[model samples]
Target chain A: QKEVEQDPGPLSVPEGAIVSLNCTYSNSAFQYFMWYRQYSRKGPELLMYTYSSGNKEDGRFTAQVDKSSKYISLFIRDSQPSDSATYLCASAANRGSTLGRLYFGRGTQLTVWP
Target chain B: NAGVTQTPKFRILKIGQSMTLQCTQDMNHNYMYWYRQDPGMGLKLIYYSVGAGITDKGEVPNGYNVSRSTTEDFPLRLELAAPSQTSVYFCASSYSMTLKSANEKLFFGSGTQLSVL
Candidate 1:
């Protein structure tokens, strides 16, 4: 099974709508969950980050992780057309004293229509 | 800081041809990684290094090799290009995985699009 699973969504939403994106994982060892936004032909950029199972809020973006259920979510409030991009979920196991490599999900393409 | 820079933004390779994808970071990060993103697929780790002189294979490492001779440079080499190797390659770096600050984020390069024919 893939380590991380996300719907490759071409999810279209009206401007100013609240957008919720989700991902499921199979590795319980993953300790760091991250959300990245990527525009066409560009690399992924870090949008939100969370550690373990909890919720973190950053302005209009919130990241939630439920280790028990092996699920994670990213909520974007007051979405705008500029928010239209591919959202990728990534996770990594925290090494004792180092940053481990991250595993990513198939990105979901989001489009916000004005 | 030009966080991470990748060279040869795009390339087209014939079968059996070889090339190198260059990556350089000015953040003085200790961890560097190479990943490839295929169409509609998640990014797959090709190789990673925690520090200069140390390298490890990731989820997908075949048909490629990497060397970290210095802290600022990590290059991926394609010895014999194959059609299956065509993909967008990304190079990333982080200060350290153990840090707790949000700024200790993974910064990625623009990406190198490779087409192996």
Candidate 2:
């Protein structure tokens, strides 16, 4: 099985709606969790990052990590059209090949309609 | 800082042709990585270097090679291009004070779109 799994969603939502993106992983060694935003033809940009399990808030985005369940999520409040993009969840194990290379999810494509 | 920069934003090659995807970072980060993103798939690591002259493979490394001769650059080379190798390539770099540091905040390049026909 893949180390990380996420629902590849083309989830469509109207402006001002709440959006939630999630991912689950099987690697217990993963110690760092992150969320990235990728627009078409662009590389994935780091959106949020957290260590261990907890919630980190930045602006309209919130990242939650549950080490016990190996699950992570990104929540966007009052979403806007400018927020439309693919959201990717990634994790890193301290002692892995590639020196902290992130294991990424398939990504959840979100569309915030105006 | 230009964080990370990749050359040849787009390229097309015939089968068995060879090419190199160049990556450079001004951050002077010790950790640099090369990844490929295929349609409907998550990014797969091709190669990574933690420091100059120290390179290693990631999840997907076949048909590809990499070199880290300097702290600022890590280049990925395809010896014999194949159609299956066509994908968007990304170069990323991160700084960790120690070798075992758990931090993995990555800064990526714009990307290089390559088509192997």
Could you tell me every candidate's TM-score relative to the true structure? Answer: 0.95, 0.92
lDDT of 2 at A104: 90
Per-residue alpha-carbon lDDT of candidate 1 for residues B14-63, written as tens digits (9 for 90 to 100): 99999999999998988999999999999998998999999999889999
lDDT minimum window of 10 residues, candidate 1 chain B: B96-105
Per residue, candidate 2 scores C-alpha lDDT tens digits across B22-110 of 99999979889899998778999888888999998888999999999999999999999999999999999888622243354678899
> What lDDT does model 2 reach?
0.88
Top candidate, metric DockQ: 1
Best by lDDT: 1
Clashes of each: 1, 0
Task: Please tell me the interface RMSD, in Å, for model 1.
Answer: 2.0
Off by over 4 Å in 1: none
TM-score of 2: 0.92
Cα shift from native, residue A36, model 2 (Å): 0.9
Question: What tens-digit string does per-residue lDDT give for candidate 1 at A1-114?
Answer: 998999998899999999999999998889888899999989999899888899999999999999999999999999999999999998888775434567899999999999
Q: Model 2, stretches more than 4 Å misplaced?
A: A96-99, B97-104
A16-79 per-residue lDDT for model 2 (tens digits): 9999999999999887788889998888887988878899999999999999889999999999
